[model samples]
Target: MNSSASSVVDPAAPPRSNPIRIGVSACLLGREVRWDGGHKRDRFVTDGLGRFVEFVPLCPEVESGLSIPRPTLRLAGEIDDPRLVFGDSGADYTEVMRSFARARLHTLADLDLCGFILKSDSPSCGLERVRVYGKGGMALRKGRGLFAAELAARFPLLPLEEEGRLNDAKLRETFVERVFAYRRWLDFVAAGVSLARMVDFHRIHKYLLLAHSPEHYAACGRLVARGKALSRAELREQYGELFMRGMARAATRGRHTNVLQHMAGYFKKQLDAASKDELHRTLDDYSDGLVPLIVPITLIRHHVRVFGLAYLEEQVYLAPHPKELMLRNQV
Candidate 1:
C-alpha cells in the first residue's frame, strides 16, 4: 500500500475532456488502400474500439507514392536490412519507403498518439513475423515490416499491436489497457512534473503495476521515495520507462489473485462474515477459472463503493479502460 498521505485523484479524469488519439493502418479501418484495392477491415478496430478513440490512419504503401492495385511487394535480402521489392520484377523500393517513413514519422510525433494498430503480415506495416526472402527465393517469417520498424524505433514507449493479434482476448485487453495508461501518463507529464504529482501518480497506479509486475512496482516505489534527491528529468524518464514496461507485461492469474487479495485487506474491518465469504468465493472462482475476471472485479468494485474506500477507488486496476469495452468480461 502507498504511504503517501496526499489525496488521490482519478487518473481517467484528464481524457474525459480530450479524445484519445491512436495511429492505425488505414486498411484496417475499411479504407481501400491495399494492393488489391480492397480493404482488410477489422470490425473490432472499426466498430468496437473506435467508439472511444480518434484514429489517425496511414497507409505506408499508398502514402509512399504507390498506386492502388499496385504490384505485390515482398522483403528480400538480409533479414536485418531487407529491401522492399516488387514480387514479379524485383524492383527495389527500399530507399523510397525508408525516406517516406522518416518524414511521416516526424509529422506523427506531434499527434501525441497513445497507441498504434498495424496490419499483420504486411511488407510495410507488419509488427513481426513478416516474410523475408533469401537469395534462392525462400522466405522466413522473422522480419518486421519497414514502416513498423521505423515507428517502433522512433517511439519505443508507445503501445503497439498488430490488428490480427487483437483477436486473442487477453492480448486485446492488455493492449487496450496500455493505451489508456499511456494516455494517463501523457496527461500527467503535460500537467507538469514535480515530486508531489509524481507521488500521486505512483500512488494511484500501485495496484495496476503490481498485477503486471511486482518487481517494477517496487522499483518505482523506491524511486519515488527518494525522488527529492534526484533531478526531476531523471525521475520522470526512469518512472515513465518502468511504468510502460510494467504495463507491457501480461498479468497472469496468480498475479491478479495476489492483487485482489491485497485489495480485500482494505475492507477487512467493514465486511461481515457472509460478505467476506462471498468475496473469498468469487476470488476462488476467478482463480479456478470458473468465471471471467469481470466477476471478481465487479464484486470488489461493489465493496469499494459500499465502504467508500477512497484509495481503492482511485486505483486504476478496477477500471483501466471503459467498462463498455467489456475487456474484463473475457479475461
Candidate 2:
C-alpha cells in the first residue's frame, strides 16, 4: 500500500514448469473406493480446482488392504485417541490404519504437496467434526480422521480443508489462496532461501498479509528487519510460521475494507475526481457487503495497469490464485 520508492518491486518470477500438486481423498476425486464401492465426487474438486492442480489421490481404506463393499468404519473410544473400527461388528482396525498412515505419510512427504482436500465425515480422511463414539455407543463430532491427523502433524503449515467446507465461498477463497501462497513459498525455499529472498517474499505478499492480520504483517516486518542477526534456518522457520499463521486467520470484511482503502491511497494523485469518487463508492459498496471482493479488486487492478504501478502490480493480493477459479467473485 505504501507507494514509497523504497518499496520493493519483485520481478515477476517465471511460471512454474510443474503443476501445483494437491493431495486429496480418493473418493472425492470420484474413485470408487468407499466401503460401499461408491464415490463421493465433488464437482468443484474435480471440475473446478482440478483444472489447475494435479491431484495425488489416496483412499486409506483401499490402500490399507480393505476390500470394496467392506464393512463401514467409524471412530470409537476416547476422543483424544479414537479407534477405527467396523461400524456394525466393532472389529478394530486402528493399528492397521495407523501403521498404513505412518508409512504412507513418509511417502507423501516427498511429494511437495501444496494442500489437501479430505472427504467430509470420513472415518479415515475427514478434516474435522468426524463422529467419535464413546461408551454406550454415544457419538460426538469431535474427531479428526487418522490419516488427516497424521498429515496435519507431518506438515503443520500445509493448507487443508474438507470438501464440504469448500462449498463456502469465503472458506474456498482462503483455502485456494493459501495453497497458491504455499506453492510460492515452496518455490522460494527450493530456489535457496536467503535474507534478501526473504525480504522479497515478504514484500510481494505485503498487502495480502495485511488483509488478514495487520498485527502479523508488522510482526513479520520486524522479523525480517532482524534477519541478519539470526541463522538462515531460524529466520526461515520463524518467518514461515508467522506468515502461514497470518494467512490462516480469517480475512473479515472490515480487514478487507481496510486493506482496500490502503491500496486505494496509491491512486490519489493519478486519478481524476470522478474516477476517485467511483473507486470510493466501489470500496464502500464492498464494505457494506453489497458486492463481492472481486469488484473493487478488479477496479484497483485496472488502475494499477493503466498507471503502470509496478510495485502494486507485483502484489500477490491482487491475484493470489488463478482467475479461472473465481474464488473472490462470491466472497
Candidate 3:
C-alpha cells in the first residue's frame, strides 16, 4: 500500500546524494507486472520517496516465468506450505513459486539494501496482514507473504515494509528514517570504523532522537558507553539491535516535539519552571498517545534552529564518521 503514508515532496531541495538502496515491487513504480499487465504507478514512491532512495524494482512472478495477465492468486493453507493458485482456473504451481522466492532472495542478498517496499497482499511480497486459511480458503489470518517471509527469516536485520502501508505518514516517515540510519550503520561497517567512531557518529542524533523516545535516546547512550570494550563487529551488532528495537516504538509527533524542547534546554544555561512544565505537558500528551511523535519533534527542531545550537551542526553527539556520511542526507 504505497498509498498508506504518502511522503511530502520537497521540490526546492537539491537531489539527495548516496541514496539509500530500497527494494521495491516493479508494479509500484508503474512497471507492468500484474496478472492483468498493468501498474500501481505510485508517484509518491517514484518521486517523493524516490528523492532519497534508489529503488531496485523486482517482479517475482514475471521473473519466475508466470505469464502476464494470468489469474490472480492468494495464499492457501499454512504459512510454510502456502500455495499460490489461480483463483478462477485452479492452476497451481507451488514448486515454481517456491523456487522463484528462493531465487529472488539470493539475488537480493548481494545488494547493499537498507530497506524494502513490497507489494501488499501479494502471495509473493506482503510484509504483514497476509491472508491465510485452514487447509482451504476458509478463515484467513493475517501473516506475511511467502517470499517476504523467507527473505525476512534469512536476513533478519534488514528493514521491510509494504507499499500499501507507506501512505500512512507516520509509518512511512519512521520506516524511511530507520532505513537511513541502517544504511549509515552498514557504511560504517564497510569503512572499518570503530565503535568509538560509531558512538561519535550518533552523538549528532542525540537531541533529535530524544524527540522520538527519551528512553531510546538514553538506552542508546548506555549502549554506546558499553561499546567501549567491544570489537568492531560486536559494537555494530549490538548497536544495530538497540537502534532497530528503538525504531520499532513508532515515536509520534507529540512525543518527539515535547522531548526535543527539553533536549534543546540541555544546551541552555537553565530552564524556568514554566519551561519545564510546558515540556511536561508535551511528554504527558505523548505518553497518553494523544499526538503524533513528529508534530512535537518538528516544534523542538524549530527551537534548536532558532537558538542556533552551533555544536549540533557539527555532529557533536557522534564520533567522526566517513566525512561524507554525515553530509550524505544534505544533498
lDDT tens readout by residue for model 3, 85-167: 76777677677877777877888777888888898888777888778755645847576767787778777778788877767
Native RMSD of candidate 2 (Å): 3.1
Query: What is the alpha-carbon RMSD of candidate 1 to the true structure?
Result: 3.2
Q: What is the C-alpha RMSD of each candidate to the true structure, in Å?
A: 3.2, 3.1, 8.3
Model 3 deviation from the true structure expressed as Cα RMSD, one decimal place? 8.3
TM per candidate:
0.95, 0.95, 0.76
lDDT of 1 by residue, 215-249 (tens): 99999999999999999999999999999999999
Can you write out model 2's per-residue Cα lDDT over 184-277, one digit (the tens) per residue? 8878888888999999999999999998888989999999999999999998899889998899887788999998888889876789999999
Better of 1 and 2 by lDDT: 1
> Candidate 3 lDDT (Cα, whole model)?
0.65
Model 2, residue 216: distance off in Å is 2.0
- How far in Å is the alpha carbon of 93 misplaced in model 1? 0.8
Residue 226 error, candidate 3, Å: 2.8
Off by over 4 Å in 3: 1-17, 79-81, 88-92, 211-219, 267-308, 314-331
Separately for all candidates shown, the number of backbone clashes (residues 3 or more apart, or on different chains) is 0, 0, 32
- TM-score between model 3 and native: 0.76
- Where model 2 places Cα greater than 4 Å from the true spot, the runs are 1-14
Residue 134 Cα positional deviation in candidate 1, in Å, after optimal superposition: 0.9
